[model samples]
Target: MRRFHIALAVADLQDSIADYSRRLGVEPTAVVPRKYALFRTDQLNFSINQMPERAGQLRHLGFEDDAASGFSSTHDVNGIEWELFSPADQDAKIPEVYGKEVIRAG
Candidate 1:
């Protein structure tokens, strides 16, 4: 099964971790204070990092698929970014995947 991944940056790591844990009803799967924390549930995979520049902001969006082969990133008209990992032969719907053009591995 493919899982969506969300990564964020926060000013306060521990506090954010605690807050998310409470909200998600579970503890973080892994944490490295002042560095990062990771959480993975059946429905989602999340991570928060202590990056001063992007604090309190989303770092990126990703898709984890065991069958995926390469990667791509794009932005919508609203400017939200997304990254997808998929096999080359797989059919990727552009409009739905957040891109106006087909992105290839560089």
Candidate 2:
């Protein structure tokens, strides 16, 4: 399973929520006033952040991987920050992927 993910900074959270809700034809999956919103459609998942410090900027860009091979980056790049929901198994080196026993380095 795969989904397209995108995130953008919004000047007005309420207005953006309404606009996206209407455009996407659905309400946000989660909404925190003056903070952020998550909109999910059939093929796209996007988040809108109410960024007063950096309005009209990209908040992040990336997709959530169910397999979570631990390749996703979770840091800032050129002032843009990205996030991913990693499985708890992420820290564990998946043996199936490595073809051998993997140990975590201290």
Candidate 3:
């Protein structure tokens, strides 16, 4: 399966998580306190980061693909970053990327 992934920067992590949970109709899969959150659904792999100055901005886009070889990222002609990774690949990178331990939410 391949799920479209979206990442955004938000002003508040907790607030965004609550709102997005309602919007997505499911709680986040993992969270890093006031830093980050990940929400995975059948068709969407969504996440948000607490970056006040970059609030409401798209951080990047990606795909959560089961058949993906490994985590990889590149930029498009417009300079928008895109990633291709499996769930396990993402799980392994979470701590390294966020520099904090994550707590599974649901």
Q: Pick the candidate with the highest TM-score.
A: 3
Give candidate 1 misplaced runs (Cα > 4 Å): 70-81, 85-106
Please give the clash total of every predicted structure, in order: 0, 0, 0
Per-residue CA lDDT of model 2 for 29-103, tens digit only, reads: 656556767776777768787887787877677665565556465666575556554324322323443334333
lDDT of each: 0.68, 0.65, 0.94
Clashing pairs in 1: none
TM-score of each: 0.64, 0.64, 0.96
Tell me how candidate 1 scores on lDDT: 0.68
Question: Residues 1-106, candidate 3, lDDT per residue (tens digit)?
Answer: 9999999999999999989999999999989888999999999999999999999999999899999988999999999999999999998889988877789864
- For model 1, what is the error of residue 22's alpha carbon versus the real structure, in angstroms, after optimal superposition? 0.7
What TM-score would candidate 2 get against the native?
0.64
* Deviation in Å, model 1, residue 77 alpha carbon: 6.0
Query: How much lDDT does candidate 2 score?
Result: 0.65
Ranking according to lDDT, highest score first: 3, 1, 2
